[model samples]
Target: MQETVRVALDAMGGDNAPGELVKGAVDAVNAKENIQVILVGKEDAIKAELSKHTYPKDRIEIRSASEVITTEEAPVTAIRRKKDSSIVVAQTMVKKGEADAFVSAGSTGAILVGGQLVVGRIRGVERPPLATLIPTTKGVSLLVDSGANVDARASHMVQFAKMGSIYMEHVIGIKKPRVAIVNVGVEEEKGSALVKETFPLLKECSDIHFTGSIEAREIPHGGADVIVAEGFSGNVILKLYEGLGSALIGEIKKGMMSTFRSKMGALLVKPALKETLKTFDATEYGGAPMLGLNGLVVKTHGNASAKEVKNTIFQCVTFKEQKINEKIKACFIKKEENE
Candidate 1:
């Protein structure tokens, strides 16, 4: 039998807290036999929501957390003050090994701050970066440091490339994933000071399949399997990618409904169109995993629906079953020995 992957879910963290979050936990437990969900939040609210669903009683449990951290609060301050907050409690579970992973659709700052301060980072990991899979024409690309370290150094980025390559090759099953730095142009010298400094390091790095620089325009075309960038640049690329995708989809839907002739055409193409569009849906990929953490900590969109939440939980299971952390540890250990 497969080992159970226990996930500590922050039930009071997102916009649809206790409702969609609870439903997601129920859906996850019902869908997989090797999964168990420990809902962390206000007991009364969580229980009320869980009561609406039918699930394996043994697969779901609730851990009461009296507080909820908000986006406006300073992450460090909130984490320190809100000792009983859902985010803090869930992360603690991971730190204590009570849960295999922690999942939250809460404040990004709180999650990032608490992940480091609470769950801690793997040794030899200079900095833990948020890594997420973004949809691409070739399938999906891993974007490292998506929003964690806004101000980073060349060494941090080089490590990002290595970790990103490892995740893509293992979890995503992409062999020898191509690694590239986000740049202003394809030329090696065309980039900011940081990129110029980091470029040569990645090129000389033997661990990853370095493919030189990749421009932002080439991203959607699946230019590289692993796109490495500092937190600031990666976050900008991700937000713009999400916004543009939404706008284009909206325009297409509007155009389809504008006229009777187009509406009839839509009926003929709806199935195929939907399948193609599903490939680009960010929710289908799940939450961003904060790579290099001692224990897994995933941060999903604050507005995530039940479907996205369920998918994120599944993503955590894959991360565990693949022994991603162990592989990452081995890579770092080898690097340390060489040094």
Candidate 2:
């Protein structure tokens, strides 16, 4: 029998909080028998949203949290003071083993700070990086330190490569995944100080299939399976990727509706176009997981809707079943043993 993956979900964390979050929890429990969701937020609001949908009563529970963290609040101060906030309560559940994972679409800073402070890091794990799956021509690639550790060192990036490889192989089922450091040019010599320093170390890693440096242009072409970078550059790439994708999609839609002839063509091509476009949809891939944490902590977009919420909850199930944390721990343990 499959063990149930218990998820602590922050019901009041996103723009569509309580309603979309509650609906997502209901959808997940209804769809998967081996999943349980503990909704954490204001009791009245959560209950009101719950009334709008029907789900397995035993599979869904509520843990009342009176406070909510906003984006403007200082992450550290908010986490320290708002002990009863939804993000805090949910992450605490993970820390205590009350839940297998914590999922939130709240303040990104709070999630990062809380994951490190409340949930804590795995043994031997330095700074845990946020690993997000970005769509590529072939399928998807894992971008490590996408929004975490801006001041990451070469050693930290090496660990990111290892962890990213583990996740892609075990959870995403990519065997012997290719690893590459992000650089301005394909040459190992071209990049910022961080990249130049990290390149040689990654190439020498025996555990991972280290490919040479990858240019940003090659990212969409699936040049590498695992792209490693410090948070500053990785975040820039992610934002640009998202912005460009949206702009192109908008232009495509506008062109398709420009004239009567285009409208006729659009009707015939809409199905195929949608199927192609779905591959690039960021929400379809779920939220970014903060790898190397003692327990799983996922941070979705602040505007995440019910679909993204549901997908993220399911992503947690895969992470649990694949024993991702255990594998990551083993990798670090082996490294420690070697050193």
Candidate 3:
């Protein structure tokens, strides 16, 4: 029998709240037979949106939440004060074992804070990291500590490398994923104090395949399957990568439309180019997951559209099926035993 994965979705969160969020929930249920979505928000608003869609009645549910958490509010304070907020309620469901996962396109701080406080962490996890998959020429690479743990220690980076390798190998279906630390230069002697300290520890890890340093320029060429860094550096690399991809795509379009002769060439390449670009659309893989949590917590873009929301919801199903949390717990426990 297939295990049903129940996801508690924050219906009142995100820039396109209630509308796109509701549509995404409906779309998710329609797309997957073993998935169920519990929409948490104002009952009237949720029902009003649901009235417009045609979906399986048994697969979608509604839970009333009175308040909504905003991005500007401090994370800890907002979570403490807004007990009835959609984000908190959804996270609570995961903590209580009522749901297998929590998904939100809400405040990043709130999600991270709530995930650690509400959903809790796996037993041996010192610090949970936000990991996202970035598109690469070979395929996708897992970026650990993407926007979490800004002031991480060498021990944290070492943990990040191990967890990232596990994620890529299990969830992403890669055999012996290559792990690399983000560095300015390839030399063993280069990098900051933290990277320098962390490098040797990662090298000593026998479970993961440490492939030395990976410069930012080589990331696009698929130099490694897992990229490790502290939150500050990882976040910067992520933003730069996103901005560059957008700019390059825009320039390609502009160049293709500049002259009549180019227009004919553009028509010839349009189909192939469109197909090629689809592989790079990060939304296809869903949101960034906060790893090491007791239950899964995924944070999507604040302005995510229905497609992104839907994809994230489906991603939850795969996570549950793979028993990722159990694997993470065992990995950390075994490491502690060895130490």
Candidate 4:
């Protein structure tokens, strides 16, 4: 019998609240046979949304969470005070081994705090980084520490590279994922003290194929498979990437609808344009996974729609099936043995 993957989703966490969250959960369970979703939030709200969809009763379960964590509240304070918050309750399920994974489109701070305090970290894993798959010219590349560990050290970046390489190779099916540090220039000497120190360490590692450096401009062009950086710079790159993609898409639509000549061209190329744009859609890849945690914790965008939520729930299945945590533990264990 296939082991069922139970995903506890924070139905009240995102902007759309129970509606999108519940729909996503329902869609995920209906789409996959060996998956189950335990929606965590107010009972009435979730049930009201669930009522809209006809799904298998056994696959979808609801666990009431009286409180909801907001973005304005201090993450640590909220987690400590709101014990019954949907985010906390869902994460607690992961810690208690009741659920295989926790998916939330909540406050990033709250999720990070709950992930560390509640779900905890894998033994020997010093820092868990937020790993997001960014669409590139040649498919996708994994960007590590995009939003977590802002003050990460050189050693932490090395671990990020190691863990990232493991993920891309195992889950992403890249034979030898090329790992690189996000740097100002392609030259080895042109980076912050942290990057300069971490460069040689990555090169010394026989496990990953560490390419020297990747400039921000080269990122969208598929420069490397695993782009490693401390959270501050990584977050900047991510925000700019998202903002630029959105602006370009908006401009493209505006141009296509401007004049009769352009409108005719648009009608002729709408199908092909949509197909190309779908490749750049961030939602298609699902949420970012906080790697190195004992149990999986995925953090999606707060404004995520049902499609993003649904994809994120399914992403958890692949993470569990790949045995990513086991592989990460072995990577650290082997490193310890060598030293």
- Candidates in order, TM-scores: namely 0.97, 0.98, 0.97, 0.97
Model 3 per-residue lDDT at 129: 95
Instruction: Write model 2 residue lDDT over 301-331, tens digit each, in one string.
Output: 8889898999999999999999999999999
lDDT of each: 0.94, 0.93, 0.92, 0.92
Model 4 accuracy (lDDT, Cα): 0.92
| Candidate 4, superposed: residue stretches over 4 Å from native | none
Model 1, position 240, has a per-residue lDDT of 94
Per-candidate clash tally: 0, 0, 0, 0
lDDT by residue (1-339, candidate 1, tens digit) is 999999999998879997999999899988999999999999999999999999999999999999999999999999999999999999999999999999999999999999999999898999899998999998999999898999999999998999999889988899999999999999866899999999999988989999999999999999999999999999999999999999999999999999999999999999999999999988888899999988999999889999999999998899999999999999999999999
Model 3, poorest ten-residue lDDT window? Answer: 277-286
lDDT of 3 by residue, 48-138 (tens): 9999999999999999999999999999999999999998899999999999999999999999999998999998888899999999888
| Model 2, runs deviating above 4 Å | none
